[model samples]
Structures are given as structure tokens and as C-alpha cells.
Target: MAEKSGKAFDFKLFRRLISYTNPYRFTFYFVALSAILLSAFAVLRPLLLQKTIDESFIPKDEKLIVFYISLILGVLLLEVIFQFLFIYFANWLGQEVIRDVRVKLFDHMLGFKKQYYDQSAVGRLVTRAVSDIETIASIFSQGLFMIISDLLKMVVILCFMLYYSWQLTLIVLAVLPFIVFATRVFQKKMKTAFEEVRTQVSNLNSFVQERITGMKIVQLFTREEIEYASFKEINEKHKKGWIKTVWYNSIFFPIAEMSSSITIGLIVWYGGLRAAQGDVITLGVVIAFIELSQMLFRPLRQIADKFNTLQMGMVAANRVFAVLDTHSKINDSGKIELQNIQGNIDFEDVLFSYIEGEEVLKGISFSVNAGETVAIVGATGAGKSTIINLLNRFYEINGGIISIDKKRIDTIDLKSLRSHIAVVLQDVFLFADTIFNNITLNDPTITEDQVVKAAREIGIHDFICSLPGGYHYNVKERGVMLSSGQRQLISFLRAYVSNPGILVLDEATSSVDSHSEQLIQDATDKITEGRTSIVIAHRLATIKNADKIIVMDSGKIVEQGNHNELLEVENGYYKNLYDVQFAEVRDV
Candidate 1:
């Protein structure tokens, strides 16, 4: 994790992050321009104070005092107004840069082939999008202003201080090397502290997210206490990291106070003598030195705090940069577009495995004719889903090819390829929105009529109408407001609405009740009427009417024929499995 954050704070990452704000350089300059004028105006106030103390107040000149006081008030008022606009623009620039980076990252994530998501967690991506991006945003907004204003103020004040008295300026300068050294030491420690904090926070976030997602499981197994304890551990780890930062800052502040006071004392004791001994120094010059000390040390305190802030931003950068640096596992050489396609799919001795040396689909070869309804049957873990995954290019085959109408899928553009196919998964996932959005999934061209027609075909439109708000009613996340059967119908509607050339129903009806199953079957027949459909079914009844039923075992096709043909092969693996399911259906 240190390595990860180390990369985040890298100069190159900041340069890239800075480049995003480059487009708004004029606005940044306006802020800087205002700051320069404001700082100039700011430094003049102390000089005005010195004049009032020595010339106006002591000599009892009321008019001069009033004049100086009015000027001071006017400068303060004007600077505040410009400073307001400057800060507003700076904040806007920061947010805009964040928006740009987030947009670019999301677009890139979408371009990454499906395989990348298969290997990564949603939690990490969530952190990158929210927390990590916010870090860079802060650096751009608040950090940039502090950096620019402090630097400019430091340079200007130092120059003025030197012009006043070279001897006194040198004394202030002597304290700086120690101040910078102390800051440098704390900076290294703070960086480690902040990086650890970020890491622990991510872990805690992941843990809480997991528990919330699996709340039912935790309750069912009576592990809520266990999970809570586990969560507390992670959360406390995060707190410890943050506490370390607070502890160090507490120590550093007193040290800063001591150093600053010592410098001021050195001035009062040493510079006072020169004033008393008839040197060129006046009460005004000594007073100016005292005022200058405040300017010098306040920025020094800010400088110390700014280092801590930089470390925090750098910690955030590490995670964000890591994600941006990731290269997608899949890429296309040239664009391939398909206007129309006949749904003839062929698998030529395809070999695939999720894990090395453990082949899931070993040299499995098959062919489906145009408009064929092929039922792929298998016992659990017999590579049925693996086969479905291959057709859609979810995972590339280690050997052989998946071709549609004899055109290789690898050569086809992913968008074009997926556009021709749709799958209804076993775990039906729906958006937390209206039924309209859930069915359409934000496809702009899909009309309301299409949504109704698709839902109607899947036998859920009437059920939706019966709900209080019907289709406009909230769907809730994962369609939790509805039954398992209703969710299945929604998933089915998604598949049918696509009007895809190739349809895959991977346990699509597994969770549906019998009545809903029959309705889904009717809709399935309608949708797959002129297209090829691949059904991965465990239910014996659903696959009975398929044009072909192929039994899979240990990643190889053990038997192939229609349902009756497989039943007739009494001596095969098909016979025993058929007897068990056949008996259960009759019992039901």
C-alpha cells in the first residue's frame, strides 16, 4: 500500500492532474492576479499602523489618524470582495478538473473489455470514483490557492524585511532552516500516516459494504456480532492512522510556537538596544520588525499545515493513478461493424479454463443452425455457464474459435458483437429506478411502447399495472420490491426488448414459479422465433421442446439429440439423470 501511495504522490501524476486545470488557466491567473493585488494591499496596512503609532497618535494629530484608519478599512473591504471572486473561481476550476478526470476515467472503464471487470471488485472502483477523485479535486482547489498565495506572500515579505534591516532579516532567516527541517521530518512521517489512513479506510469501506450486501446471510447464520466485531477492527485501524496525524500536529504546533516566540524575543531584546543607543532605528522601524515577524511566522504555520495537506492529496493520488494506469486486457485492432447477421454459431474444438491447468471446457465442439433452439444441459460445474460465457466473448478461449455465421467473434468490434446478443442471467439484476428505466437500461431510443410490449410479452406488464404506481413505481435495487418470479420476468423483458439475433437464457427461469415459468416460456418462444436461443436449464420441463438437447459432463459433450432421443439412450448418463428429474416433476 505504501508503494501504491508512493506512486500517487509522484511528480508525474501531479503534472498530469495539473494538465486538466490547464484549460482554465485564464481563470486561475485571474485568481492569482487578484491575490497579488490583495497581498500588496495587505502588506501596506502594517506600514499604515506604524505611521499612526509614531507620527499621528503620539503627536496627538486626530486628522492624520482618521485618514490612515479609513485607508486601512477601505483596503480590507476591497480585498475581501476580489478575494471572494478569486476563491469562487478557484473552487470552480477544481470541481471542473475533477469532472473532466472522472468523465475520462469512466469512458476508459467502459472501453475496457468485459474481462477486466471479471477480475476486479466494484468496491475498489467505487473508492477510485468517489474518495480518490475527491483528493485530487481538493489539491486543485484549496491547495493551489494556498500554494500560490503563501509563496508570493513569502517572497514579497522577505524582500521587504531585508530592505528594512539586513542584520534583523538575517536573524529571522537563521530560524528558517530549522523550521524547514522540522517540517521535512514531519512531512515524511505525515505522508506515511496519511497513506496508512487511506489504506485502512478503503479496507473498512470494503468490509462495511460486504456486510451490508450480505446482511441477510449474516442474520441467517447468527454472525451479526462476529461481522460487527470484524468491522470494528478495520474501523479502529483506520482511526489509529488518523490519530497518528493529530498526535504529530499537536507536537509540531508547540514546537512552532516556541521557535516563533524565540525569534520575536531575539528581535525585541537585540533591536531595542540599537533603538536606545541612538542608532538610525526608530520606534516605527522596531514596530515594523514586530509586525513583519507576524507575517513571517503565520505563513510558516501554514507552510507546515500545507505539507500535511499535500501528503493527504498524494495518498489519494496513489490510488487514482493506479486505476488510470491499468491497461485493459482486451483491445481491438480495427473497427468491425455488422449491419445484419444470421444466427449460425459454431464452436470449433474450443478449450477454456478460468484457472490454469484446470480446463473447464476441453476441446468442446458444436454447431447451431440458424434459428435453432439449443438446450445445453449439464450437472453443476460441468462448464455450462463457461460455454455461454465463451459465445459472448466474456472470457477468451484458450484454443479454437467462436464464430457467428462463420465470422470470428474476436475480429468483430465488442459493441457490435454484444449488440447482436442478449442474456438473461440467473441472478436478475435491475436498476433502482422506474420500471421504464429498468427495462430500457437508459437506452435513449427505446420508447415507452417498446418497454410495455416487452414487459407484456414476458407476462409481467399486468402485474406491474396492479402495483400502486405500476411501471412508474420504484423498482428498487435488484428488483427487491418484487418476487423472484417478477425479477425473472423483468430480466426476460430485457432480453426480448433487445430483439437480439442470439439469445442466451442462463438459468433464466430457474427461480420463477410454475405459472410464471409457463408465461416466460411462451414469451421465450415468441422472442426466439426467428433467432437462435441457447438455454442453460436445470429444469427438465423447459428444455424438453428444444430442437437439440446436448448433455454436458466434465466439460465434454456426452450425449446429443432431442429430449426424446436422449431419453431413449437408456444406457447413457442421460438416462439416470432423466429418471431422477422425471420422478420429481411427477411428485410436484
Candidate 2:
């Protein structure tokens, strides 16, 4: 677990966050100007009340009283207008900044290598990109600018109170030390509470997201009660985290309210005695002092709350910047532009490990001609899938030379290199969209007609047409509406439509029904006719007709030959695997 940051006010973070507002500085400037006007107007209202009570209301001057009332109302109207502009512009700027930041964060995430994602939870990333960014927005909407405006209003109010009666102002200032102390304590406690709350929120989101995504596994294994119990514990922590924040708020606000009330009582008592003694203090001065005291302390109370927003926003910004600062992206230093690659692939003296010092592929060497179909047969954990991951440069090899058409694969442009290859994985994924959209992936250039043609070529067009809405049928999330075989067919069509020079089917037919397997086999023949193809299979019967078969064990290729040639070798790994699979089929 990462240690929590101890610093409260991170000025460096504040400055960096402010830089995002550069694009909308004009709007921010408008908000600032409105704040100044609003502060001026707010001060004028209390002064107008003082004057009305002393001069207009106390005297028998109806006309003067009416004039003063109208003036006060006019000041209020302007205050309302400026307040509207301040809120509108502040929120608008905040929303705009968050939009840009979200996009930038997503783009940065896209550049991260598979290694980064391998250890990251999808739910945590979503939290950073969505909830964290929203919290940062509150720094503008309810935070820094609002605090500045409120502080300014309070400052203006203080100046007027002193000018009216310095004695009353002194009395109000006497209780200031206690308010300041209480605020410091409140802020410290709230910051800790808010931080914990955010952590719990992220944890809860991660737990729920994982559980919902893997609900099928839970149901299949009959682990619903166990999973539910685990979720309840997480949910309880989430509730406790928020309740802590609420507990702090309940203690702080009442203390502030009590202090404000005590100040009002003190003003009323002191001014009454002075007035009765026939001193300088009058009813108007006493009334204004009470109002001014409220004005002064109200903002102080608000500042504490706004500071919470600022603190949470800073924490969010810290997380977001951490992601932005990561340098774990794949090195796209290779500038080679090889268009229309011949699909000749070579892996020589390759070494790789998903974990350091634990090699999954050890000094492996292999080659595939431009237009040959090769089958890789292996048991679980034999580094079959790792081969595909390394080939596509999803991960950097520990030590190796992987080349295409005699050119180093690393020297080729990543986009261009990936454009010429497509892999249909065993666990096929489909979007919650129509069959047509899933096949084309919403690529504008790949027309519906073209997708239909590709599907027909793969022998799944008729099956697709039999479904309701045909090509336009919605597959639901992860293609949950379709059978496993139908999903595989969709994957095949998606791969075929790309017209990749090299086709990789990584256990693509392992989980499908026999009928679906036949369709996939037929699709395989049509699509891999002239393409360089590598098929990773556990079911040995699927690759009997391949041009060559490579048998692997413990990250090493133990045997390589055509089916008949390999089967003839007594005690060979391929022969044993083939015999075991054939016997199992016969038993079935």
C-alpha cells in the first residue's frame, strides 16, 4: 500500500493545476472581476442599513427613507447579477478544464505498455479518469476562487466595521483566536477523513467492478455467498469512511455557530450599556456591528468547508499527475516504415519473462515463411500465449531478435507493424453493439456490405442472418447474448475484414461447440489460404493438416515436423499429446 501524503497545502500542486486554466483565462478573469464587484456590493448593504436606521428611519423624513431603501435595493440587484456571473463563469471554466484533463489522461493511458496495465485494476483506472477528475473540478467551482471571493468580502466587511466603530470591531476581533484554532483542528481532521473516504470509494469501486465483471465465474463456482460476504465487508468500510467525514462536520459547524452567536450577544450587551450611559454608541451602530460580526464569521466558517474541497481536489490532482508522469510507455523509437510487409517472421535466441528472473520463454528460435501455416501445440503454462504477446510487441523481449521480412521488428513503426497483423484470441470479446458495428469496429472505411461479404466467406453469414435484426442485432455487453461459437465467428470476421498479412489464432477454437468448431475451421481455411498464420492449440486434432507443427514444453520446442513425420517418432512429446487426445475422443 502507498503511504498517504502528510503535507496539507501543496503550493507546487496548486500552481500546476492553475496552468490548466490557461486556455479559459478569459472566463476566469471575468469571474475574478465579478468577485470584486460582489464583494464591494456586499459591504455596501450593511453600511446602507446603518445609514438608513440612523439618518432616514430615526427621522420623520419619508422621502429620504424611500430614497435610501431604493439605493439599498439597487446595490442588492447588482450584487445578484455579479453573483450569477461569478457562479456561471466559475463552473463553466471548471467543466472545461476537467474535460481537457480527462481527454489528456485517457490519451496517456493509451500509451502505457502492457506491463503497466498488467498490475493495474481496471476499476482503479476508471476512478482516476472519472471520479478523480470530477473532484479536481470542484477546486474551481467551490474551492480556490470561492475562498478568495469570500475572504475578500470578509475583508471589506471588516474595514467598514472598523470605520463605523473601532471599539465594536475590537470586541469582535477578541474571539477571532478561538475561531482560528477551531478551524485549524477542523481542517486537519476533515483532511484525514476525506482522504480515507476517497480511498474507500476507490476500493469499493474496484471490488464491485471486478465482482460484476466476473459474476459468471462466481455463479459457475457456486461462490455467491462467499463473494457477497466479501462485498458486505467492503461496503461497510465505505460506509464508515463517509460517516467519519460526517462526524467531523457535525462537531465543527456547531462550534462555529456557537462562536458567532456569542459574538452577537456580546455586541448587543456592550452597545446597550454604552447607549444607556449616553455615550457615542447608538442603535444604528449596534445593529450594524451585529450584522458585520455575522458577515465576518460566516466566511470563516465557509472557508473551512471550501478548504475541504481544495484539499480533496489537490489529492485528486496528485493521483492524476502520477499517471501523467509515468514513463512506462513502450519505446516508439523505431522509425522504420515498412508497408505491405511480406509476413516473413523470425524469432531468434529470444528470451522473455513476465516476471523478472523467471523466464517463460527461454532462448526460443523459430521462423515462418511468408505464406505458410504453422501450428504450435503445447500444454498449459508451456509459454504458448506468451509467444503471441511477445510477437506483437505487447511486451519488450528480455533478449531477442524478432524481425519481419529480414528487418528488425523493433525498428518498424508500431502502428504500421500492428496494422499488418491480427490475432483472434481464445477468449473473444465483442462490444455491446450490433453485429455489423462489432465486425467493422465502427471503422468508417469498412462498409456493411464488405462485412457481409467477409462473413459469407467465413460461412457464418447465414447464421448471423437467422438472428433477430440480422446484422443489426444488438449483442449486449461482451456479446453475452450470443453463444460462444457465434462470438468466435464474429471474431473471425473481424480479423478477416482487416486483411492482415499475418493471422494468429490463439486457442480460438478451444471452447466452441463442434458445429461452431466446423464453421471456425472452414473460416480458418478461407482466411489463412495465402496469409502467414500461427495457430496455438491445445486440442491436437485441430492442426493435423498444418504445413508444420512445433511441439513445446517448459518454454522449449522439443519437436518440429509435419503431422505424419512427428507422429512416427516414438516417445516424442507431439506423439504422446496426439495419442492422448485421440484416445480421449475415442472414449467420448
Q: Pick the candidate with the highest lDDT.
A: 2
TM-score, cand. 1 vs. native: 0.95
**After superposition, candidate 2 runs with Cα above 4 Å error:** 1-4
Please give the distance, in angstroms, between residue 28's alpha carbon in candidate 2 and its true position after superposition: 0.9
**What C-alpha lDDT do the candidate models reach, one value each?**
0.81, 0.90
Report the C-alpha displacement of residue 146, candidate 1, in angstroms: 0.7
Residue-level lDDT for 15 in candidate 2: 88
Candidate 1's residue-wise lDDT over 274-317, tens digit each? 88997866667678878887787777778668756766776676
Output the lDDT of residue 391, model 2. Answer: 78
Q: Write the per-residue lDDT of candidate 2 for residues 389-443, one digit (tens) a residue.
A: 8778899999989998998878988888887889999999999999999988998
